[model samples]
Target: MAASLFLARRSLRLPFPRIVRTSKWCGVPALGVHTTAGRMNTNQQDFEKSQNDLKILKKDPGNDIKLKLYALFKQATQGSCNTPKPGMLDFVNKAKWDAWNSLGSLSKDEARKSYVELVNNLVSSEAPLKDSASLSTREQYDTLQVVSEDNITKIFLNRPEKKNAITLQMYEEIGLALDEAAKDDSVITVLTGYGDYFCSGNDLNNFTSIPPEGKEKMARDSAVILQAFVRKFIDFPKPLIAVINGPAVGISVTILGLFDLVYATDRATFHTPFSQLGQSPEGCSSYTFPRIMGLSKAVEVLLFNKLLTAHEACKLGLVTEVFTDGTFQKEVWERLRAFGELPKNSLAFSKQLIRETEKEKLHAVNVQECERLRERWLSEECMNAIIRFFQKKAKL
Candidate 1:
């Protein structure tokens, strides 16, 4: 198993400085605008204010409010949503596209003005924007810490008491952070865990709280959110690095396969107990692990539930390096800073070339895994296992 894994790892090693030239697709042609300098400044001010209001409203808004905000923002920025409507079953996307497209022939300035007015009205009647933090200012999140400086963004899993267990909200916040990282070309993202562990995986309390009758609904809903979160990582164009501080389990361990680099503390360990939990593989590990660690090692980790030490993980090529616990975080950050100092486009395009070939296959596997996971979530075996697992935790 080790020999085959080693040979497979050799095949997956990235080629440096090969410079694969590729054509870039620039989406949405720029619209011509004829406005006086003073008018441009006024329009820009209104746009900025509208953006701030939208950010404030996003703190806690109903689905209706969110859709409205999305529409107004898109209209103001893009000038009337020229993209084709999403498919029928894509209800959320279609609703957003329709809402934006409804304001047909509205000019950018007019849309911006309308957005400001709508936000002001919403704030006055329903909620006050003053009560919420502006989106421009980074608010400290409950479950994660996102700090960007020196051209490196570090996203830390902050719920140490629960062993950094990921809640649904944490997943959303991580997705948002990734979205931000995608927009900013200057920064590289580094994901790490706080306290003694990287991530204990999903907070089972959230999953077990679903009533038996609501299992199917919860399965579908959670799958949608989880799939979106996983897709964000898979499609992330910028360099993403993972720093494993300690032991990691479940999705936390599997997710390392998607990162551009993974550095771990010598004390860190990785385990995927999906089968024990009556669940299947996630984070496209079903596809990526075999490609990284070979089929036999992938089975041992995903099927037989093997727990690998950091050194073993590095040997299997899942981790780039394993550092002593004392200096792990510092060393990882230093490397990230060094990486950030390199030519940004060169790194990004290199990563793109390396990953673009596997993008379609990874997406397909993610879809298939989500389908299987949904079934597993709704199954009697999974339900029973979850109950027992919770009972065991309670005893502890």
Candidate 2:
């Protein structure tokens, strides 16, 4: 929860191989800075090397399992650059498969990089793009068949006109999905989104429907959705990944901490901004955010209502990876398949062990903090402040 600076949703335009220089307030040099014009240039040679490696991966049948999986993921997730899905595995000759298997048996780093590259290729691919069609419709919601990288189950999110905000019913639907994923062994992962946003946290418009006394219940309900979602994610012995397409604020970004991996686009922005808006952190972020990032950084994010760029979040270890906007979904699958290739039980065991060690203590802390914050929120001063903030934003 590092307090984040505002991020413009524009595409990155970094100059290559140039150096930039800056002196910190404490006379510290940032780890990756080069001296030029206060900007760091991405090395062109590195980009070329990445490209060449990808080209070899795509062309060489030696790496076909990873390649075919990457291709399948690209097809499933709507990426442009992909090997055709029809007979994708069959397309790989035996020699190529042998080569890929042999390579897989080599260094773990090489295999991991190879996995990332395949995901990156699928994510950054630029042809044969598919469309996410709406598969079901309802009065206030529509389910979509989103582009996903390597999994069979397609994700569905509330695509109502109201900015795809979460509602009680929507939470129920989402909860059911997670439960289903937990039980279904074939479903290795689930990717979620809501229209242009990953999720806008809660639909505050629903607040008016609750009586004043019921506000506490509303807060509790919100917490339940968040808690259940995160708990299922943390305890779900399989790999779970979230591809954050855009502004994953409040609970959206918070819940991401529960997942095994998260991939976000350059356009993605994460924020809490809850304390500033008169609410406290939820989604167990009160605990998870602080652990993943230190308390001071988390305080900066939560207290200031800061917004962070995907790149900044990556640096803070919030986001697992970032991709350009166009390639975001494809890149997500790349990350997902890396998880898919591992032995399922081993992955589950590691995740379970991690959670088992910390669950009781952190969960209690989260509950206690949330309760205290909820009580504080009921104060007249907080109410007035919330009203005023909403009024000011409304006028704008």
Candidate 3:
């Protein structure tokens, strides 16, 4: 059993698409208007404009005066809604829980655009905003639109075409985003992915694109990317939560092993079929799976290539909780917010200590597992198995 486990772990490979590059942009396109150097100037202008508008509104609280002034401001901004988004509004409400009675008449569109621009500004500047602590934004792919919500401190993985299959660029962007989050005191927790489907795992198309000869290098490099993402999630003092909405396979399922809390929908599925596919789990599942789910359960999941439903995963201690697909988001929000509502600093410190102590050893184990996997991926035996599988699929 131990030998089989070792062989399976070594067979894992991280494939990258040679023909296509992973995008750094999360989901938004480049405006080309604000350069990184000039982002500060743009933000200062927006900040000043917002401040001036605030002063006028404070001077006159009367409905007639406030309405007239706000309307004019709206027109000047081309009638764009300045109202915060559902996620942003939630944060604002928390900050000013007592004062926030009802939302004022403001345009949602205006708020969204403004928020996007602000994020772009920070990305260009690579600097945190004055009122805001840290901000990082990047497009994950050319076609996909993955934006980090303003107040939620969320990182959305949004490549629907390939089911959010992670690429080299996506891994790099995620690593940088976490680094930025680490620097900011305000960012207490990091939430990942959109509704369902955290990540579909490795892009199989990559097998055909890259030089098959360099397959070993590609897998090793990809392992580095997964290592960075998992290391950050595991070591970061802040809470790391993964909202698994749909299918999570391969590296996706393994990466979840690092998250402190995981909430999956009833329809969600988690699996690591590397053995069936003739590979292994690169994100340190060799070590993490056995520790979290026990050796017997880990072997059942990794060696047999079994797909576990949300309920099944919960039974194996893989998932924290499961809810109906429709109500998953609402329930997750309520649960996370309750945690966020606690003394922010104290919560952060406690989370950090727990992660550091437990994850420190796993990090080393992950490095060892990944290095060995690269060697196996380049082995002739595994190569022949991969070739046979693909040839069969092509015949079908």
Candidate 4:
């Protein structure tokens, strides 16, 4: 994101072309472009060409990236966010304001360059996804293996070496996979891991490594990413399932509240050590955890860093069922494949009815959790805690 911000800023010395939104364009946005002939340098020419290409794209680059592009364009063209922040209930406008405001005092030239580079990348990378939609060709993602078959789209977390711990790129990839699955003909979408562990949660490197943009900015960017990532699950249309092949931790465990069904292996454990790292709740766990497991149990895991066994999690309503380790995959897949043959529309509509009333509350909780986490990430306690964590790991 920092690199993209640099490229986007550098490319913006020239004016970007205006974007017209008619529901056909992807994430290019609807910024008004300046077309003064005198300013049409080679860079501006490339920018305009990129704009043209972006308007032709049929696939979205996900909501987070779109907000990013929108913010960059706004900063590049009209200077820093000047409009009054929208009301709390105005989700769309408020989100737009937040994205643009997160840029802080980034100069117009920088914003322009960032917007152009992002647009170019979006245009270039989009075709591959479109072509890969067919069952004959699986969707290509950097950190996820997405394939549709037997009326189900299975998204496998492919970083076994990292215990499937998610990186920033992985978050984006998973969201994109979910977007693809949501619209595809698949009756169900299954999230699982490639290795023995379902997901060990956050890749600590994300916290330890500070980019040139600095820690606070990275935290801002990460919060944006986090909100977008969780939003995918919150708004997912199909029956989303978690096939917990093994241990799950951090956001991986927190997000299960959003899944329609969670099947775990008897050996699988769930843990959320938020306070251990001086971080606050995220993945909307602040609300969902207490609601699902009651206040006492939620406080134990979320505040005191308690870990839960598979059976315990199941009893708490986090996991729907648990199978023995040896037969976990075989039994789970056999049942899932059967479930896939169910009526897609019926399942979708039923889920909608079940989820409709709570969607707004979930979205609100997501915003609150993400914002709080962003502040926590920028706190002295969190930074020092992460440093100590790395030091402890080195000794072991």
- Each prediction's Cα RMSD? 21.4, 17.3, 16.1, 20.3
lDDT of 4 by residue, 4-57 (tens): 110000011112223334423324445445666656455556655656765675
Error of 1 at 96 (Å): 56
- Each candidate structure's TM-score, on Cα atoms with residue i matched to residue i, is 0.64, 0.60, 0.61, 0.65
Note the residue pairs that clash in candidate 1.
none
- Model 3, 1-396: lDDT tens digits are 111112222112113221111122111222233335566556545534443333322111122112222343333233433344354446423323222213244453444344333323222211111234333444444422333333335566655435566655666667666776666644345544532245666555444455565665676665565566667766666667777767677777876777778888786888777765556665667877898889988998888888899999998888999986534556676676566566757767887777767676888877776666666676776677666766766675
Q: Model 1 residue 289 lDDT?
A: 95
| lDDT for model 1 | 0.69
Q: 1 or 4, which is superior by lDDT?
A: 4
Q: After superposition, which runs of candidate 2 have C-alpha atoms over 4 Å from their true positions?
A: 1-154, 211-226
lDDT winner: 4
- Specify the highest-TM-score model's number: 4
Instruction: Tell me the RMSD of model 3 versus the true structure.
Output: 16.1
How many steric clashes between backbone atoms does each model show?
Answer: 0, 22, 18, 9
Name the lDDT value of residue 291 in candidate 1: 90
Q: Runs in model 1 with CA error above 4 Å?
A: 1-137, 211-213, 391-396
Alpha-carbon shift of residue 96 in model 2 (angstroms): 49
Error of 4 at 357 (Å): 0.4
How close to the true structure is residue 67 of candidate 1, measured as C-alpha lDDT?
50
Error of model 3, residue 210, in angstroms: 4.2
lDDT of each: 0.69, 0.52, 0.55, 0.74
**Model 2 per-residue lDDT at 21:** 20
